[model samples]
Target: MESRPKVTPLTRPSARRSHVPPLGVHPTPDGGIDVAVAASHADGVELCLVDVVEPHRDAHDPARYAERRFPLDGPVYGVWHGHVPHVRPGQRYGFRVHGAWDPEAGQRHNPAKLLVDPYARGLVGDLTYGPETLGAVSAPRRPDEPDSPDGRWWVAERYGAPDDRDSLAHVPHSVVVASHPGPPPLSRPRVPWADTVVYEAHVKGLTATHPDVPPELRGTYAGVAHPAMIEHLTSLGVTTLELLPIHAFADEPRLVAHGLTNYWGYQTLGFFAPHAAYATRSARGAGPAAVLDEVRGMVHLLHEAGIEVLLDVVYNHTCEGGDDALHVSWRGLDNAGYYLHDGASPAALADVTGTGNSLDFRRPRVVQLALDSLRYWAEVVGVDGFRFDLAVTLGRTQHGFSPDHPFLVALQTDPVLNNLKLVAEPWDVGPGGWQTGNFPPPTAEWNDRFRDAVRGFWLDAPREGSHGRPMHGLRELTTRLAGSADLFGHSDPPLVRGPVASVNYVTAHDGFTLADLVAYDHKHNEANGEDNRDGSDHNLSWNHGVEGHAPRGAEGGDTATEPWSAVVPLRRRSQRNLLAMLLLSAGTPMLTAGDELGRSQGGNNNAYAQDNEISWIDWDLEDAARDLLDTTRFLLALRREHPALRADSFFLGTPRPGEDEPDLLWFDADGAPMDREAWDMAGRRVVQMLRPGPDDGDAHVLLALNGGLDDVGITLPPAAGGGSWERVWSSSWDRPEAPDDEADDVTLESLSVEVFLNR
Candidate 1:
């Protein structure tokens, strides 16, 4: 192995008097700013002051602003000097630190590189990506290559030229505040955990081109809080709006090179600051409080409408990236201490997040930062809960991912966050990753099994013939519908059963939309600038007949205007099937944005890089799409009508009254008991399931699935006591009401699911 570069600790002389700029004012004691940067790092640091009086001050404004250099002393981090004059909110500022530049040893620092404050409350300007921002540094030369790396630094560069590519600088500390002032009083409707329905959406993509939302409000925080958006969410009967990451994030340098930006704000730079771009008004003109006030107002408005707010947080890694990355707060403060460094070298980071470095939860300060951020958002920001991104990373100690990790324990025991809904992404790109059921009882995780199994039984399995026949046994589907006890056992209480422990979903922001899943057999990500090598290969998708937007060559290239052929019916049926399975399942269900109205990614499975039409949800839906929306509303009503489907506890896999068999049973096409040999058969494509009656002994439900290519006869099981089975709902059928008694034994069509009730 090659030897690593030399490492050295840089130190600066202490000053007798404080020269740091004054910290901004705090409206409330709890909302005051903490100078964490001063206390954390011991390098040459200085705070740049931008004048608030000069409204249109530029970066080169010498008279209006000044830079004060400061040095750290033992114990006393720095002085605040209270709220100084001419230094209110909406001030643009940054930090200049003179540090070492040794990428081989994992420390790349240049005083010339203007850096953003890691804890800035708000941002002022947009980042300009290119080579001029790269700073006066050179890559180390390889022994085999004779060229000196020094010539690259002094080369003159043009704005759009290839050599000027490194000039693109990321505005790391540009934080955006709510446009209005003060946190809105908590007035949202309170729905119990068992009855909660979560609707996950992206603020920008959800209404970027929405027709109903006002043009000014579209694609902004104000737009999402508009009456149109609220009415839509309310109509769907969603109790909580689980938003994707909204914190101020940095657009990757490479994405900018490809003329794209980070659609999902996962690369966080400011934990306390909201992304200003999502605000309808400009942060510079409206003031920092404008952004802050608008966000709080949105939360309050949603609350008033009986909805909860759950923010998706990303704390696994900072936007600063790798060793050669920028020296933002965490890296400058104490790189080795704040990040997970190699055990052997101590100064080298152990890149676990695949985004460069993973935060060191083992450190007391690092753990405190995370806990404090969470509490700040929940209490100060007035959010209902948090969905942690790569949560397993925060739970890892020296041993492994532990439920007793300090961060987990703190959240479970924290007074402020304990009552709030706590959710976890459950896994990171690290060793011992993919911890689905391993989260503490207090936190609910996104159930990947639910996503895969449901997709497998309905679409993936039948097309590929992977999991012993394309369609699974009714016994297996019943277990999933009633909550998977096999995955989450009885180790926890009924209130914390596997069902409540999981957040069920068929599609999410990371993969294909519900529509695209039923329209594309393979991923089409050639537009991602990676030659289709960027997205996941195991999509588990199936194209009904065509691949991209056009029909396949095998179908004689028919371009008819059929409902299913045009992506409308397929989207509706797939969404209805997925939603019915999700809401009717025992776990809490989450609905993706626009899935209720048949949104499509144009058959693009992975759209992480496509910030344009490929990722944005088309708010304008056709009549068929409107019908799909109605179907979603109807399904939500059905879910709300029955408590059995959303039980906090898992139902025992045993026989029940009002049903001929157990709470769950596997049956063949003839409605006969399925044997082990039959269950293992790879060609089996049909199964029937029976859900036990509610605890109060109300009605029983029988679900049937057929993944075969042709219609098949399905014999009805003998009804319990003296009742007869009635067809209540079918994916192939249009109406909500069941068919007449004349169809006792129904013929199920290919790629169809039906629900029957015993009356």
Candidate 2:
């Protein structure tokens, strides 16, 4: 491992003592802008003030712009500081880092390249990707291709190239945004982990095609906080809106080439800036400062309605792909210092994130950059929390992943970040990357095991497709439904992360939606441009007798083009089963954007590249979709009304100290407690979970699930809640309407789940 200095907070030098107190474009007392950038090993760095020739540009064309450069004062504590008196808000600016062009020594600096300030709060214009934009220095390329240098192509053995080609014309300019207007309002409805119901939605998709959101404001940040959107969130009992990445990001060059964009916004550029594309056209015209104001305005509105906003942040890698040839942004500034490199050779990247390059958290400078960006968003943007995408990369050390890594410790102890809802997508592609249950206490991690287990039980039990094998045994399901104590319940150091540590969900943005899980057995990812080989094939899904949507007629027939009306019951019931398990289970539940309404991506499991109708939510729901929405509302309501469903602590399964009945009672098909053999056996698909409310409370919840293909009668044990059973909900019911009374013994329909409440 390359040796580097560690920066403990106590030992770190103060920025104010050296002169510039803050990085990025901060307003001065005298109306100038103080711009600071961190380039640790750069020989020289210049702040460039650019003038725009036009607000728009053509594709594969040089941006109409020019630049005047000013040398930064010093490399003080790795930060280059300067004050530009002429530059103000909306003023286009960027940095030109100068140093060695050697790649083996971990330096790819070319003054011809325009680098983005890592702390840019507002990025103006989008990066136009071409040879000039990607790199000014010629990189070794294909033997057959011509080289484009100085805006002209040369094909003389493809060897002629311009060394002095300035890439400023195609590079994005970082805008000097003035400080935010006053302070963001301090009122936040910080939802507790137990009661928090996270609705994971992309900011644009949530409102883009909504009927109620105004036409002009349909896909903007303002639309997300609009009254129409807020009303839906409130009505659905959503406590937190976990938005997909809204940071300034660039679509992958491949996706752009295919005329598709990164809809999920996973690839990040400026971590501090809100994506300008998602802002209103007026906001973009008003300039970069208004873009941030609109984001804060969204937060303020959601906070007022007692809802929290959690951002899905990507800190693991930059949009600068792994190619050492690209001299833009981070790669241009300090390639060696910013990103992790293979120890054997610095030219090759050690990318654990599978995103081309992994940011080196081992370096304190990069750590400071992330910490600063987070503080900016939480304190300045006024957002509630952050869900770190591929968070395992952040906590990975030189040896492997560590729970007590410097960055993890800093987050747990840092005052600003400690109060926020820190979530981790805890796994990467590197060695020992599966750290799902390994994150420290007081934070949650997305539980893929929970996802797989649930999907296997409901969808994979009956079929042995090329997709995968049969269902996982009852033991796995029981463990996941009860908060996966075997995983997250760490007794070491006496820190037992409770049920809330698991962020339980069966579907997310990267995979098939809940609707697709019921409607398709195979992925239809032809729209993603990679043919059908792009998305995951191991989708534990069962198409209800037909692929895609089949009309609601021909109930008694079985043919190739059969309407498959009989298939509808099992599909609907299965959908209900997934949602009920997600909401009622002992963990923090995350519902995807359109999953509540049975939204289908036409079986495209991975829709990361699809930005059009296939990805944008269709809010105008049909009859069946509307029914799923109502079911979602009711499920959320049940979870809210009963504290037992959202348990703060994990159930021990054994009887409590003075009570004969355990908090949770698990049983098999015959209403008998599950024994060792039953827990390990397959084909025994019937299970009942009985949960008692708070101590001495009269209400309780009983959930019965039968995965069999035939209706089975099961006897209900004596009521633990001390009242007759009211059939609160059933997956098989056509309407799923008002609750009906049921006898002690009830017949569960094939492929169904039933809920009963003792009141």
Candidate 3:
């Protein structure tokens, strides 16, 4: 008979417990690990030590692995704690809390559902979406039961009973990770807000189809850190690289049923754990520890290239979803405490986000969870900052969205978080959720108003003629083009929230690409399995008479047809106009990943589910794409070199003591100063904006924009301080090559933009 290895017994590390144990499992100085979890309503919490199963045996089968459960000591301020000797790093574990199954009171405790640690630093395995992971038995609504407002009556059925199926197999195992020594501390590239140019991209989509990236490293953390990828970012002159959600996430069952995955990764499973799928295959083969190191490597490489990494985090919701969804973590541990529920119906979830459930930021523990996760990513993971998704939900309290909400206040007060970049999406689907420009100081917001105004002035207004009405005036466009003082400025204190607070962008990941905004008026999201009914219909776009792709050669084809040959050039010019407005504006600008290269999703505004080529950026450079990239580079260089465009404070309009003209002056096509009526005139589509240099010694900048159907003559105003004007960039050019110096009179093309500098 084969001799079996001797089994060792776990020893007790200590009996004394502190006032409050730190949450999550931490390796002790002794050989053991100390585990603590917050489960307020649980009667007893058991720590389950799991043994790795054999490769040949079904690794996903819970019954295949041996698990030993130990009761922990706690309920001291709602925290459960314990210390087990012999548990080392890389050990897989989970929690099972025993409590009353009273759904009406929001105390959902099912010991059979193994729960993931909310503070787990690393996780292994993928969450299998099935009956095993669902904490409650999902039943069909009875004929006698009344329907809910959401129209899904079966969602209420989750409160009926506890599911007894063991969830150890289907759920991801939380692994104990010890702090490993890494390369010397990264020197962060803390680019100031004024000089910050955010380039929002996806870890996978950005490099998946990159031609130069090694095939094995493509679409992985290592891929982003690859030299080829870093070169692109550096060459583009973007100061910050904002990546989409990298938190460990799971695909919703509905998406999985339709043979699709959550490509956007908004559904977060483990905040602390790096999304394992994003790691290179080599790192993944080495386990969770290696996966985390890959993420750090990416950040380190980016920082080395003088680029900051900002994660688009989803703290408002979890992958567990709503009442009828799976319950792998928070819900199973303490449902009443972790999630927000309706005041009248305690069992029903309060979903401010379009997602099924929203985390209750009102609760202290929930707030603690989010803060802890953020600290881990910032300090341990080495990311420079975060862009919080659905940030308005985080600021929502019992009363409503408050600037002083506990979570928001805590972030401002926290020593680690306050110094880091904090960006808020600034809206949710909840009541009174539009809280733009209401966030605290030092926090920048995604400026949707700037996006709308720029799109309307360039793409919409000309397509839909403005018939001499005050409604289509330059007031709205100018407000956004300037610092948007009407929205971000405080008259009481003057420039309290400066132009830095507005993150201007014409296109984001959620909307149409820069090319699509000019090529398709309607969204073509037929592949999302929603029958093209999903995605926003309020896209303020103009197709320039073409519905889909322009005739051959317009978008890199062999030859071009009649109107399309003309329309395509106009579309490309419109794109340039939009890009120029965003970069030249006196606010921090954000550029979408493939917008510079003119990448399009074939009119699919929302490609959150199409994980294939539809979302991945194609690296094949066409003539138009190459020109757009060069134009982007030129604009970025202009913004970087000129302090006028990157204003630290709002323009005072009045000239400084040493200046010859007002700090900013607006002129009409006739070269005369614009009056009140001219500012509101609808048919008046041409405007010349002049901004003085930082000092009398520097060159003053001039921007002349013509947003009409017919070309107009613009008599350039005399330089702000009186030097000759030289035309630098123009949308009329096929390439970004500097245009010849022009005199007083220049013909501005229809729907085109021009930039000039006075030296």
Candidate 4:
């Protein structure tokens, strides 16, 4: 059991005193490679060397390589280590751990299953969800059961006897890469939390259909760094580009069977390896190292443009899925130590992430794995921050989620991770999972409250007795505009996490685009092959006068030839209103990609599986699309210039040093300050918010909104120093080309937003 020898092996006097190698395949100074793995319950571990038969063969070809197994030496502190002579870069490998197959004790080790190293820096090929990849056999189908069209007969009996069929041909191989996997490290943009305007985008969907991007680079990492994309982001005032998962992932078997794919990239396979599919054709052909360089190059270019890069990392669960899923990695390597269990004889996995399995953060090794991965991305790959998907699950313990959990504490105290931006999705499917404001300081959260409040104020139609008003009143709207102080403002330790802790967003990747939000009252997810019952029904949306204005090749099956409805103007106004609130509020704002272009999925709220035209951003903009883009750019630029809009701290309603006017003042339509009666009125549709600029020399800003269907004359409140109000922008106009108007009494159009500055 040895590798094809070129150099002689080095030996120590005693194996007990020999030093253990670090985990994963690391090339040593000597002409050999050191391999280490933690297989606590395994009887033996064998390192398999793979020789590629054809370099450019199909990624999933079963006979793509020939493998030779060599036994490794260890069990020291439950870790296995070995050195193979003459191993060099680009060598493909995997591991086989031999141990007891007693699922009752949660030891699911199967030598028959070849496992990818969890710490592999480079991985090639994709996983096939065939019988070879499963740890256990499918249960016997009853006479009444229906046949599986995909040959996935029935649910797997995970506790039954192990399936001895070899899985070497079904899964990917871990490649031994050079120590420096990516390009030379570049300085990170390191954008401040308060000043960051995050633009959430999918690497492929962002520029897949862009007319300006070259055909060779489209739908790849190189496409993201294209000058056209860079110019768009920079001109739009985006300070950060938050990418969806770039980690290697696998499409769920169900999605494969349905003839669809997981376009969201949430199902992670290898955390260390970049998804090769995202690289250009030349890079993929060049091998795994080239793919890494392409990813690094994108980050480098984005950083050069003064934009930060944040990764949406999914560490809550692996792509291996649940009890009835594949055994490609952790499940086969160390099932008991890696995953949470329900305390049964044959322990059932405790799944908090909807993806089927939840990793146990209680284990030190598991926490180490997460911490190591974070450091690698931050230091090696040069990313600015991370947004944890299903973050609540990472902080969960036996008693439930705790802010003081070891993993969370470690992140806050770690030297390499503490300074980076840490954002939490802040919820899971588990009990007490909605811990929105419970995370510790410095950890920002996605504010669903902001999304709902803004959407309700602008999109929901008037209810009975509400006098043509939207569902929410002045109080709700004002609260969100002021940064939802009740949620983020804490008194236990005054301003522990200020208004900046809230990431305000009206629409995100999971739901409808901003355009669809104003045009569809219900979700059209029938394209997902789950009937119409797959997505959320409580959309809190209003279709206005028409059911939909389907874009070209929309997934909802609507025709593009349908005439525009009369309510089109109103829908555009509502989009402007939502965007204004999101950008002008006293919190960090996150804009979804393509919202600026008024992109639509034809009312398909859940387009996660629609990887084609429905999900890819259509860059061929019409007149209306161009107008919306201009509006977004104008709003973003205004927010950047005005410090009052993106206030770092919450307003206290009291006067600041040497200022007579309060830091923030509320006014009624009559130019008088709002009283208790006005604040509590449900029929009130118009409200004014006045905020002082950063300094006395700067102009004070006032935001006025009319949520009613008719015109409302708003009497301008005198500035602290007494000056006329200059109307700089209005949502009534289709674009921001309207001239600035100076007036004391400004009439606001129906469902419109207007901003004023006192000169």
The residue pairs found clashing in candidate 2 are none
Q: How close is candidate 1 to the true structure, as a TM-score?
A: 0.83
At residue 376, give the lDDT of candidate 3: 86
- What are the per-residue Cα lDDT tens digits for candidate 2 across 1-759? 422222112122334537755878787878788878888777778888887666476622345564677777667877888787856677878888777766666666767777788888888766765566554334433222132222322111111232456667666678877776533556789888999999999888888899988988988999999999899899999999999999999876666656678888988989998999999999988988888899989999899999999999999998887653345699878888999988755367898988788999999988988999998898888888999999999998889899999888888899999889999998989999888889997679999999998888888875542235554445677778888877788856543778898999999998999988988989999777676778789998888668886654442334324446567666788899889889889999999988887788888999998777888889877677788889999999999998879888888887778878788988776778877887767657789988887666657888998876678999776775356777888888655695546778889987788888887
TM per candidate comes to: 0.83, 0.91, 0.94, 0.93
Find the 10 residues in a row with the least total lDDT in model 2: 151-160
In candidate 1 the C-alpha lDDT for residue 675 amounts to 77
Cα lDDT, all candidates: 0.67, 0.80, 0.85, 0.83
Which one wins by TM-score: 2 or 3? 3
Candidate 3 has what TM-score? 0.94
Tens-digit lDDT track for model 3 on 586-635? 88999999999998899999999989998999999887889999999999
Judged by TM-score, which candidate is best?
3
Pairs in clash, predicted candidate 4: none
State the TM-score for model 2: 0.91
**On a 0 to 100 scale, what is the lDDT of residue 212 in model 3?**
95
**What tens-digit string does per-residue lDDT give for candidate 4 at 463-487?**
2223443445557778988977888
lDDT order, best first, reads 3, 4, 2, 1
Winner on TM-score between 2 and 4 is 4
Of models 1 and 4, which has the larger lDDT?
4
Candidate 3: give its CA RMSD in angstroms. Answer: 4.4
* lDDT value for model 1: 0.67
